[model samples]
Structures are given as structure tokens and as C-alpha cells.
Target: MTEMSSAPTVLVGAGNMGGAMLAGWLDSDTDAGSYIIVDPSPSPTVQLLIDKHGLRHEKAAPSDVEAAIVVLAVKPQMMETALPALTGMIGDDTLCISIAAGTTVSTIQSFLGDIAVVRAMPNTPAMVGRGITGAWANAAVSPAQRDAADRMLSVTGPVEWVDEEPLIDAITAVSGSGPAYVFYLAECMAEAGRRAGLDEDIAMRLARATVSGAGELMRRSDDPAETLRKNVTSPGGTTAAALDVLMGGDAMQDLLTRAVAAAKKRAGELAG
Candidate 1:
């Protein structure tokens, strides 16, 4: 295994998500000199990373260098213009990882040649180091390369791998966009609290703390979420009353199913 300090990891974009991963790596004690940050306009946060790490910064990918891993974090729409510049940098042994949504392994391979490619979907919470990633690799990736990809992505959060590339679209629907769904839930909950006569500020604070605390509990607990809900609910109580509305005819479940389906369909559309 290559030492984290000596490994050549080229980051293609140091935007929010990418910068978060870089910060996580730095915090985890990976050497500052390990990264080559390629961004046309570095954000203030990324500029700090450049200064702290003594990282190599370039407006475009350098032609002569070989990287152990090249991470592509640009927007899907910008991929066409961005990818061609790095084609020369991708050698057969290099593991190329893409965090852009709706971009496929085949499309990435087409741009960079037949190199190992891993397509990853990571949500926004990664900015705070709470993100989760779903990844799928093409046939060219060896077991070692897959492990390396997992290690690199794990810097942001837990990494889950799907056997089939298409499954990444489902992963996209679930976890990639899941944070927004949770945020919207908090918004609605706060509005409901306001309707229940709480002050707007208090409502928002309660909603935020409730959602985040429950999420942390879910993360730390071994019991199923259903059990956790049942434990909180009393017979014919306020919690039960709310559950009746939410669970009535499986309203929440059906609604979420439709939402996820729509998201998956849109993801597939974007892939094409």
C-alpha cells in the first residue's frame, strides 16, 4: 500500500464537496503534499487548503504527471469541457473516481480511455463530515484499486459499493439526494410547530434539534428504526396520533416511494 503522504492524489475540483473531502483527509493526517488541486477559480476555503498543505495548484491538469488516483468532482454539465484536459494524466494503473451525479462509468471511460473508473454519489452533509457515498466501479478496476477508491472516498463518510452500475441511480435517489429530503422534512416540521402556536424561532430550533438528535440516535443504535419509533410512541398518545396521520394507508411510505421513483427516473434521464 502506498503511504498516504507519498500517494499522488489529484483532485479535479475543490468546490464544496471536494473541499470537504480534502479537509477530512487533512484532518485525518494525510500529508498536505499528497494533493494536486486542479481548479480554475479556487474558493477562499480551497485557497487556505493550498496554503496549508503546500499543495500543487493548477488551473488545468498538468500533462506530465501521473496520479495514483484522480478524483473528478466537477458538475455533470461541465464534465465535457473538464474531462478532456485530464485525459493525458490518466494512465492504465491510475484509479479515476468521479463524484459528479448522473455521469456514467462508460461515459467517463470514453473520455479518459479504458482506465479504471469509479462513479460516486455523495450528499451535502459531507461538508460537515457526515456524508455517505455510494460507489460503482467499471470492470477494469482491480480489487486493490477498488479498495483504494473506498479508502479515498471514506475520507468523507462511509462508502457503500453496488455490484451493478445502474444501481448507483437508485443509490442516487436514496442517499445522494436524501439530505435535501431530510432538510425539507425539518422545514415542514417547523411550519407545523408554528401552526401549533410555537414561536417561529423556537419551532425551527426544536425541529432542527429533533431531527439531528434522532439521526444521531439512529446512527448509534443497533435497534431498527421501527423499534425506536415504537419505543417513543405511547398508546392513544400524541405520538401515536401523529403516526396515524403519517402511517394511515401508508401515506408517508407511498409518498416516499413515489418521490424516490421520480428521482431515480430523473437520474436515469440525466445519465443519458
Candidate 2:
């Protein structure tokens, strides 16, 4: 494995997503001594990890240390307030990776100045080590730095790299916000089942299990989702009847397309 760097990695937040990433790093056997956590008020879970690993912790970015890698996991609205203190930790070779949604690379550089920056979007499922990340690196990033970023980001799951920055917004619409969509699907499914005469608790259980099980099946299957759908759907059968409603005149497709577009548009607005 390539050494990430000799200098310590400065993590600027320890909220849910930040804590998840930190836990993944330690679980992957990353040197606990190599991290400097800079959260003012870490959650109990994060505090436990820090104490367990004996990692260095600080209420704010320390001026004495120059970071090789910096992970910004603060909220978008908090970036302005949080970033200024972190400027002292960045050096010429520092690779900054920001996972906060709607915060652009240029915006980060504005505070930290021109250095390597990789703007990434990772979903909530990362807390469970099953998330996917969409990442874009600026021109300043070196190959080694990019590889290091990939390794750190991939601890949760797959990392999808995009050539253009704008595509990150589209990814935000899809996978970044996709988990909530899945959850809402389960909600709708449960309600439908309840209306169809199943007991409320039983309907919810069925919906939850069905959604999660299907997701697992897709994860393990080599065949595409369409093929899997077709495999279970017999001609003139119950599955086909459901598909007729969902697929008829592209109803689902159009609805999802419009929904994704709206999300992407809002992401752009937030970035600005």
C-alpha cells in the first residue's frame, strides 16, 4: 500500500458522516496516530472511537501541525465558519477532500487558498459501510493524492469518479439522495399493503424486508436490474400486473426523471 503521507490527516468534523468515515478508517487499520480530529463537540460514539484508538483530538485546528490530508465533513452552511480555522493546517502539498454537499471546490480554495481539492458526495448509508461516493478532483491534485483519497473514500463502498464537476450534482440527485427515496418507497409500499387488507405491522415488516432483500439481491447478482425484474415477472402473472402499472406509458420513469432534475437544480442553487 502506498503511504498516504508522513504528515497527519486533519479531520475537521465528527458528526454522523464524519464519525462514520473515521470509524471506517480505524477499522481498515489506518494508523490512529496519523489522525488529528478537530471537532469541538464530538458525539458520544466519536468520543468513544477517539478514546479507544488513543488518537489525537483537538477542539480546533492546531496551527503547529501541517496536514498531508484534510477531510472536511462539516455541513455546507457551517463551511464558512469552520474553514477559516483550518487554513493554518494546510500546506503546499495538502490534499483536501470535502464531503459536505453543495460546497464547491472553488469555495474551499477561497478559504484555504489554491491547493489540491477533491469534492465528494457520500450518502447516509455510509454509516452502515454500504454507501457509494461520487468524487471529482481538481487539476491541482496529484496521482498519489487521488489514490489516497480513493482508498479513504472507498472504505464505505464504491467510489465513482466523474470527469466534470457538474456531474457531481447529478450524482447528488441520484445516489446521494437515493437512499431517502428507497426509504420513502418502503413507506409507500407499507401503506399500500395496509390499504390492501394486510395488518399494519405485518405490512410494514413485509415492505421493509422486501426492499432490503431486493437491494441485497441486486448487490450480489451479476445480471442487471431489468433482468432480475424479468426473472421474477411471469407473463400475465401478478408481478407483470404490477409492472404494467409502474411501467405503463413510462409513468415511473418520467416521475423519477423530473424528481432527479429538481434535486440537481437545487444542488446547483445551493452551490452558488
Query: For model 2, how does the per-residue alpha-carbon lDDT over 149-206 read when each residue is reduced to its tens digit?
Result: 9998998889999999999999999999999899999999999999999999999999
Model 1, TM vs. native: 0.96
Clashes of 1: 0
For model 1, residues 109-182, the per-residue Cα lDDT tens digits are 87889898999999998898889999998889888888878877888789999899899999999999899899
RMSD of each: 1.5, 1.0
Candidate 2 residue 119 Cα shift, in angstroms, is 0.6
- Pairs of colliding residues, candidate 1: none
- Report the poorest 10 consecutive residues by lDDT, candidate 1: 1-10
Residue 126's lDDT within candidate 2 is: 96
- The C-alpha stretches of model 1 lying farther than 4 A from their native spots are 1-7
